[model samples]
Target chain A: MNITAKAHEDLILVTVGEDRIDAACAIQFKERMRELTQAPSSRVILDLSTVAFLDSSGLGAVVAVMKLLGPDRKLELSGLTPTVAKVFHLTRMDTVFTIHPSLPDGLQKAG
Target chain B: MELVFDSNLDAVRGGLADLLDSGPLCAMEADARGTAEIVLAEVFNNVVEHAYATRQGRIKVCLKNHPDGVLVTVIDSGSPFPQQQLPQGLLPEINAWDDLPEGGFGWYLIRSQVRHLSYQREGKHNRLTFCLPY
Candidate 1:
């Protein structure tokens, strides 16, 4: 239920505060993101460093956030736990967004 | 061990996490535990969202530890699986950013990581089983 948002230069970083993005919070997660992005940015990143678990509903929430950004803006990802990373890889969503091992790495890649 | 869980969304997930926390089955090889957690969460959430819908119902979860893996049997007295036939080897094509699919990845993820995944409807109860065989 805790979704944090910040701005890093050109990119706005939204961090997931919960250990899981499952059904328990997916809908709320999406709703929160809609509110988080009320002040829009050209580039966005979802920081999943604290997220230890993810399910399809969680994954869908991420996808929905990505779509909300539209084509002009991009949603990059940083700090994906193995299980979460596996979900991205298995679903071939790793190709959909730029993913990095850490926020620094994501920043470096964004440059 | 068996648990008759509340049909609430949070209850299904929290109940499974509690069950897994009460055992070493989640400590299996590599990502075995995470895989089991996600699969179980998906199925249980599906029951609450689809089967139970707006109505409250009973979901019986039986956790049997086997030599090779853990066998999870979830019995629910709600509507049967809506999909007439579960899709086989469904790997959605996400070639581009716009190609990204928002939903429908739950069963695919479950089937890909699990073994002996089976489902049945006995009268009013929908029985689904799968193994976290590491």
Candidate 2:
């Protein structure tokens, strides 16, 4: 559940620094997300480039985070590894959120 | 290849690591290996969360490589399925964002990734078998 949050001008770019998010750490992941996303930001972009694996529990945790953001705010995702992307695709959750191939140009250099 | 571990979420992670890092699973292509991990994790955790709920037990996993794919059998000394049968594994309905599903995707994922899913209860154990195509 290692995640770092950087505040851009209008959004918070949160990068997950873990290789796997599964049943073992799904709850902690959600709780940490709640704490990191407390600051007001219209949009939050989650970078999952480093995450090589995510199971159903991990996927649910991501959905829970999006719901926590509520209607006013948005939770976008970027850098979905093949396995993580497959989970979203199979569950049809891919259509539920806005997915980016990678971070926008400005934030790319921040990492 | 066979692996036995305590029925806990953390142990499930460690067991998967061990299973994937050695044996035939270790030699799989990257994409196939990723799918194997995802499908196996869901299956193992379900037994920990549902079958062994509020109790402690051991889970045994056996993997055999075939010409087409790898066959997996997971045995647990815990509760059987509600009606001694598997779930329909239909996709959960996607509703409003606020009401989106946070769970119920486990069976769907397992069902989608594996083939020839079979569940049987013999004596005091529950046996679930599935095949992962390479």
Candidate 3:
């Protein structure tokens, strides 16, 4: 789970640098996410543009990150590939997270 | 094709990826390969977490490819599911993030992606068979 985090204003944009997030990387993803998100701003935008595939474990990891962010902070998602978006839609997780079509869309809105 | 591996997270991921090779049934259509990949990942992880639990064992996976669809069979010798059956229907009623669900979406995603899914326990082995169209 090679994830990169950068802060922009009151938002922190985290990008996942992996083609797939499954059971193999779910733990690592969550652990790294917790570290990256320790110092939170008003919002955190998770960019999944590079993630071509996501499983339930991956979905859970995202949820965990969201909870770790607590209620005061917000977690948004962007750049979901078709396959990755399908997981969110099928699980109805799309309703839980504010999703954007692209990183720029989320970034602009967050700003 | 058959794959037998330790009931571990890493192995589960590798096993699901192995099923998505560039074969005929593994063709790319409506993101079917991606569907199978996600479905297999969820189902395989369930076996490792629930069936195998903390016990060390091997999960036997078989992939049967057909012109119309593909059948995936997963066999594990650990404890059978609590219900000894697949959850009826899929998706849970999740409309808000107020009480966001942290889990319980694995089976729903699996069922929604596949053409058919089934689970059964024969003696000491739990057999789960699911099929998806390409």
Candidate 4:
């Protein structure tokens, strides 16, 4: 899995360039998200445009990041592909976090 | 038997999809695409996670179109997951309104999807095989 981080304004955007963020990459993904959230950002947008699939491990990693962010910070999701989005929806996580259709939408909403 | 992936999850799915697309297994009455993908993801994720904990390891996956259904086997030298000790019972009722929990659902999905799932540690390698029947 390849993850690229870019800081924009008070938001840190982490774009994941992996097909699946399952158990294999969950720990690393969690670690990176943790580091990003610690830097004082109002919002963290997880760009999943390139991610095609996610399983329990991948979902756990996202949840872990959400927990680390606590209630003070905002963690939003964007660009969830149909398959990936289905997993979130099936787990009922769609209602738990703010999910946007695109990066700009997520950023605009966060702003 | 068809060889489609070289251990990577993306490649594994691609291989599985391609094989299913070209083989007789594709015509099966049951919808195993989603189930197969989920099961493969869980097993492959385990390889990418625990087996290659510090160093990178390679995994070999093979899908065989059987007379009854399909047999998928993942072979890796990484850490092994104990199939016998798997948690058994009904799926936990998920409250969609609340936050989602991480990790346990993979096991739940794997158990629910496949008919006979087994994991065996052979020497230093682990082989996880699951049979999905039509």
The better-scoring model by lDDT among 2 and 3 is 2
Each model's TM-score for chain A is 0.89, 0.97, 0.92, 0.88
DockQ of 1: 0.74
Name the best candidate (by lDDT). Answer: 2
What is candidate 3's lDDT per residue for B96-126, written digit by digit as tens?
Answer: 4556676788877777777757788899999
Residue A72 lDDT in model 1?
A: 90
Model 3, residue A108: C-alpha shift (Å)? 10
Per-candidate DockQ versus the true complex? Answer: 0.74, 0.89, 0.65, 0.29
Query: Lowest summed-lDDT stretch of 10 residues in model 2 chain B?
Result: B64-73
lDDT of 2 by residue, B1-134 (tens): 99999999989989999999998899899888988998999999999999999799999999999777889999999999999999888899999878999999999989988888999999999999989889
Q: Which candidate do you rate higher for lDDT, 1 or 3?
A: 1
* Cα error of candidate 4 at position A31, Å: 1.9
Docking class of 3: medium
Candidate 2 chain A: 10-residue stretch with minimal lDDT: A1-10
Rank the candidate models, highest DockQ first: 2, 1, 3, 4
Question: lDDT score, residue B80, model 1?
Answer: 78
Write one digit per residue (lDDT tens) for candidate 1, span A13-107: 78878888887888899999888877768888788988988888889889988888888998888899988998888888888888878886445
Two-way DockQ contest, 3 vs 4, winner:
3
Order of candidate numbers by lDDT, starting with the best: 2, 1, 3, 4
RMSD of each: 2.9, 1.0, 2.9, 5.5
Q: Per-residue CA lDDT of candidate 1, range B86-117, in tens?
A: 44658776756776788888878889888888
- Report the C-alpha displacement of residue B57, candidate 1, in angstroms: 1.0
Candidate no. 3 TM-score: 0.88
- Assess the local accuracy of residue A106 in candidate 2 as a C-alpha lDDT between 0 and 100: 92
The residue-by-residue lDDT of candidate 4 on B1-134, one tens digit each, is 54534555555456556755655556655445655666667666556656666666677767777665688777878665545344463444555323446656666667776776877888988877878666
